[model samples]
Target chain A: MRHDDLCHEVVSNLPTHGDCFVARDATRNDSGAIMDDENKKQINERYEKHLEKGERFWPDTIFRDLIMSLGIFTLLILLATFVGIPAEPKADPSDTSYIPRPEWYFLFLFKFLALYGQLPVIGKIEWLATVLVPSVALGVLTLIPFIERSPRRHYSKRVLPISIMTIMVVGIVLLTLMSEVPTVSEDGSTLLGTLQTVVGIFIPLTAYVLLFVFKNNTRLMLWTTGLAAVSMIFISGTVLTLAPEKKTEETEVATTLVDQIFAGQDLYSVHCTECHGDDGSIAVIEGVEGLEGEKITPIHSRDVLYTITDSAMLEVIAYGRPNAGMPPFGKTYGGELSRSEMDYIVVFMRYMWDDRFEVPQEALKPLFPPLAEGEVPSYNVHILPIVKRYCISCHRPGKDNNNYLMTTYEEILTTGDNAANNIIAGDENSYFLQVIQEQPIMNPENPEEELIGVMPPTRPLKPNVVDAFLRWIMNGMPRTAAETGALSTTPTPEVTPTP
Target chain B: MWKNIYLWLDERIGFNDLNKNLLDRPEPKTTWWNTLGSASLFLFVLQGLTGIFLTVYYTPSPDHAYDSVQYIMEGVAFGWLIRGIHHWGATLMVILVFIHMLRVFYTASFKYPRELTWLIGIGLFLTTLGMGFTGYLLPWNQKAFWATTVGTQIAGTAPYIGEFILKALRGGPDLSALTLQRFFSAHIWMIPAALAGLIGVHLFLIIKHGESHFPTKDD
Candidate 1:
């Protein structure tokens, strides 16, 4: 009887047999005639013979499995201990600039969808790559046992399925490797895209077609799969080599409470210190462009900290009190700070000012490493952190700071209108030096007008900070620690006057 | 006194029958590749244990999820190790299961009496991926958030029911607190339960059939 007739018979007689296995076996007996009852009996006999000679599963198979599992356990612990998950910033639904990527395993499919989208007509149909291709592939994979019905166990006998799978697996791995390489370059060149299509989609596809055509010829099938896989790998390697170096975005994520507080403090100093005083104690904002003389509640006050929850505080900062003359600080509202940055600022306020939160000792460490008596302070070691904390808020671009941008070391010295006189090497009378010391640089043309106000109009730099600037300028403004080390003057007892 | 207690328990448990049926069965000679299946099982258990520990501290709300994870890493002792194992175990589980499937496919061990096992194995593989997808969103970090957004968006591309599927997966029109809560439920309870059930059947089938022998040219 035909397989359909047998299936119908089994279904019709399913109620008579209480055991479902009986019906299943009857259907299989007819459908799987490739391995007939005689063939199955012989296979069973062969398996029985092998079992007689084989080792016991208890000690042998179990032993290998235990060893493998133990090895994996060790590897997992090592990975967990040494390469812990990299910290990622909290989700910001409004941050559209973030390039979203799936977990590593799904990268192959991600690349496949991207490369497939470059196809002319069909690519426009989103479901073909996104839903259809994957569903079909998984369907084929799931039904492999029934699809390859030959019952051929050896690799030599199952050349078609084996070769197809080999090419498919190779394609998956290669596509994953090429996931970071964009299909199109920024300049709209499609060379990389076309090449990726070949590696990811075309080569494997062509090889599958050719393999089926050459199915009867095992050698030809193997050669097609081999050549296709090799070419895919080779072309992907070329694509990778030619690929532009990806710009690694350095976003410092503070993992520890101490680090978070420090990060928050630095951000608070730059962004908030202008409106609120350095300690968040200013009742009225002063010297700020639009909000001068505006009265505001002290954020550090117990009323504010105790009354406002963290979420409420976050919203207040992010949305800002428009009527109260406070501008939004969140990126979602067109401000500069990201969600994590805002979180850090909140953390800083809680630990530094709130009586409820106990601050960690490490968070209280000085901003920069303290200098020995004669040690020189470099731009990198001392000045950058100091500038970032105290100066960058106003000194940065689009601010009211006389076109002087302190965002970078070069810009600090070179960009301002008073660039020539801002940081004259070894000149104590430089405009930058004069301003930060609470010394206003008087306009030479009009002596009554201040060319620049004392730096950081809100608060004076601590004595140590001023001294570092003094040492940095006196040492001719070295940029690196190595450069500053060469200029260091060892403390000599001879130079010290007896008290 | 120990012997009397052991005897009493063994009488009820039938240790000898278990040894005969489960552990002491004869099999074809296996290789290192054959160990991948059991290794995958071991990883699953490891993940389950660590995941349970994670859920103790993990709050499934967008507002607290990120902070809770931070607290897990910072405030709770040995929380990092548990979370780390879970994180890496997930990646390792996917790899081992895939390789194990490949090994079974390449060896044609999925043929004849083992076809149902292969079918169940496929379910396990897909569910393992589902676990990864769901577990990823629980952290509610930028990477996890955006990845899930795009992931659900891709699911939403199916012709007829795509929108429904997307909504169903995300628990609404967009990823929100509800999406996080549902994903947390699926990750800890639903997917793992499905996996455990399927694993039990898979193990039963393996024991029933014994390991398949390496094929040779002899007919």
Candidate 2:
């Protein structure tokens, strides 16, 4: 009989309701070999007696059968949402100093290769582990089903294959642990730990030995896995135990400045995260009713928080005034704020401003008058020296200027793509004219318009140099001091105080 | 109806029940090499499950990928655990699929009649890896984002076809919204569909080949 006939016959014997062809077919085997009149059907079927146990892929595999599995997975996905991840504050482009790392999964490989790069002789082949080893490992893995196809189902004979697999698992897990852990010295500079000598080198050396000598046994794979896992755990735990806690922050039981700042966080969160944002950085302005295109400068940045003083910070917060954009917030301007309440806002601002700064407000004020037009203050004697000192550290050609080149006077004129278009002649309209204006309301907040991100990015412009450059720009912006003798004759010695 | 098709396939494709008991032939299954396909299938399920969990909050923007991933690592409850599982699971799947391919090649399982299945499997492997590489760039973090930038930049370095491939992979000349959306869709839908189809074809061929008979020849 055909296979389909056999399948139908097999299905009939199984338990089913009487409404279908199944029950009648099983009760009475009446059909003859209907192909011929001379031949009759076989009455006794050998396989039909034991019909309960069938083949692995018996019965129709329907879409409905698979949907339940899919449902379970869908439920798992739903559960993950509730148990979902927490997002860190959004990235700050200005904070280019933050070191980026890979996802935790890749961390093992990352940390592994970093270790491999430390090895000698074959060391430069560290890419072999980071790139090639994993590649080859997967290559060998995909090639497995073809290597040993003898139908040997037992584990004893499968030792070599299993060993190879175990080694990879162990290696990856160990590397992952190392990447995540902090480094610390073992012991208090006394006796070495009992396992230190063997732990450091012997273990790895022994694994290498086993790869050759004990390649066929399960022991090698087991040991390799064990050693990797143990080392990872030990290294991580020991480092964590001996590692110094953050050296900068101390618990101020006696009420320190940080404590006061911490106390003010709640108030700040309610009022500040809206504009300055949760991290005191990455300020994005949604269009509000009164404010269209209203953008608060990111405070989490090293620039704003780091540069201004606490008292100045308080005034800014209490007044809530910064040109036309920020409204006056204190009761003095019909906005609600007491002096102490204003101090709370200041505390929060200062805390965010400087991890180390704990100073008063006098530093942020403008002390000297900015140069007006027709004043030949100083350029060649003062301004040229300042450019050589502060501007060229990062803004030179063939460096990371993006496109901004300030290495030469020509490069300055070119400005490539983003020159200070705002620096208008005789008016405070150009980028060069607006940033660091004793009155800063004239310029757009875009940092790209200025040299060195508004120039001298980390420090303020010296008042004397500001006057010199201001005089030069106001005097129809002379590139060379031919007609205007503003310090053209005097050779001022370049004086940059060493950091 | 499908049963008729199976029989038709059996007769035409050199498939028979006797081939299952023919445990001495070396044309296919030689010893213990058949288990790899199973392991790879297992890991695929694991990765899919974990990946679905990760999609809950993984923003695809170039700017957000890093910070979001960091947040998941340090912020979510057992988020690191879920991420770890997904990460390790993907590594294992890739490893296993390669081994399966090797096993096929070493035994010459790709010879003639089974050649189509082998070719399809190879395509599936490449697709799987393509998925990983694309997914790798999605987190938009320092490593994921910049590594991707460097990776695409390397692709961009190709003589003439480089820029095209980079654009196709990155969804643009540089990493942007276009790149993120393209990668996200590919990771979630496109690659998965192709992988599923290939997996089905692979399984069908395995059953048709009847285990290639165990190794009776002496080593």
Candidate 3:
């Protein structure tokens, strides 16, 4: 419609609140139009009829707009404050194990491509789903104005477009919901995959075709759309139910500087402490099999700290200095640590030893809560942290610890060559207790040889740590704080009577 | 003094004309759904504000991008709040823009004299998604990195110009510092410029044609 007609429509609509300038301004703004006069006249009259009952935009429409905008602002703040963005580790291109998921809105397209790939013969054409399908969909969406050109605005007159869009939207939503369900299961079962394909592709495609065929019959088109939508949802629901439980991969992402520093400290203690010593002050590596007595720069020294950039340090850790005794500690070089772990190690080094970076006080908390006299230490509270810091480096898998792995409480109790005698509850003679106490278990078979050498051969455990272990094992090893609390004999620190 | 100041400003700025054309018009009795367009505009402004704040601390290079964001979260006052809003606003804007389009579609608002408006709306929608795609890589974190890698790779699967598209998107074969820089530029400057321009046109069209009225069966 012409600009004058729009103004006339607005002026004619608001009889209660008339604007005198509208008509004059509308006429002034009037210009040539491409639309034929007859069609424009009809549209203008229809809009004018609607406007006769319409409200003024100033107080009525603008009020709602303001309220909605305010509501949205409030929701945004709530979401920002409560469900904050989750922290992810720094990108590591070499860490191919990291699963790449697109933003949630694109998950439907991602799922559609996955399902389309399951079709026989044509499934191998990667571009069909990735490029062509999306492009075609976008093209169709963009041309919607011209495609269904009938000016019939009522739903009954517009059955075909509405139904098609409904089915399309439902399909997109269902596909996104089923994105996490694998097209093919690990055991090669394609049942869930078939169900998803039917929901995601077959039903929607068939419905669109059927809707076009019955375009003149409004009732039939609606039925087809409704049936198609229901069945698709039903099938997707089944697929979701039958879908295997996803394994939650817990990647530790330290967001705060203090957390990163502590994470770095723990990693360093486990991996670097053997060669670099606890404080990274070891000038010569000791106790490591072939690298024993190997001369190396003290890692904590200003020479190393000031000279090596973080990236360079990362490289040195990832691809170890071959001429020196340092073994690769990054996963890319066949080591145990991921890129994030290695980054944490660097952050830890800078904060703790580098004079330039001040360490956060929270990061310097004791490895475990100090034990009271006669109180028992649980594996959860005391042993786990201790084992992680002192034992797991060599005792973990692939290390020369006689198959002993202290990574878990169960592993500590059940693993190792001498599992039966590893941590015998209530027995101070347990191999673990004896070893940590600097008493190596003598090989009974060859009375002259020591079987399990003194634990953490590079350094001895502090007296307090050894004493905690002695009390813990002697009182029967507890797994939880509750269990340890029951075993405590500290007499509850006699509550004094208050007047 | 206030009346004189108001008179001077009104005479210069044409406040009466703005009110007559823009605000003091008639709209068909609107429902809550009618507010979606304005809500989307609000979100765009919010996202723009938060995004600007983010750029103050967010480095676009691979080397310092992650560290800079971490420092923002840990060191800067209310930095987390700002980044958080930007992050979530992007998501909300995409959803609102999409639903706004759907509402327009369902009401057949794209028909007749408002066809140009519909076309501009489509442009706005696509640019909104473009903004999302580019802004996602600024964090330089693992999810952003790998997702962009796969996202660009998907773009690269086109029949003939696949390699060109991929290289153009990434600025190279891989998602390196260059890709981060490119994405950052597009996120902050290029796509946003397109979005703002399209939105201007969209608003103008809406004002020119007036909001579409709810349909009724009348011959």
Every model's DockQ = 0.74, 0.04, 0.71
Candidate 1 lDDT tens digits, B4-51: 999999999999999999989998888998899999999999998898
> Model 3: residues >4 Å from true position, as ranges?
A1-36, A372-376, A420-430, A437-448, A478-499
What is candidate 3's CA lDDT for residue B70?
89
lDDT of model 2, residue A241? 58
Put down candidate 1 lDDT per residue, A374-410, tens digits, no spaces.
9999888889988887778777778787898889988
Q: Write the per-residue lDDT of candidate 3 for residues B35-109, one digit (tens) a residue.
A: 989998998999889888878888888889988988887789999888888888889889999999999999888
Per-residue lDDT of candidate 2, residues A233-267 (tens digit): 57546644544453432222212344445535544
Off by over 4 Å in 1: A1-33, A368-382, A425-429, A437-439, A462-499
Worst lDDT window (10 residues) for model 1 chain A?
A: A15-24
lDDT pick, better of 1 and 2: 1
Output DockQ, candidate 3: 0.71
Off by over 4 Å in 2: A1-54, A59-78, A91-95, A121-126, A145-153, A182-208, A215-499, B1-129, B136-174, B181-185, B188-190, B206-219
**Each model's RMSD to truth, in Å?**
7.9, 23.9, 7.1
Question: Candidate 3's residue-wise lDDT over A138-207, tens digit each?
Answer: 9999998778765556776677889989999999899889889998999999999889989888998999
Error of 3 at B217 (Å): 0.3
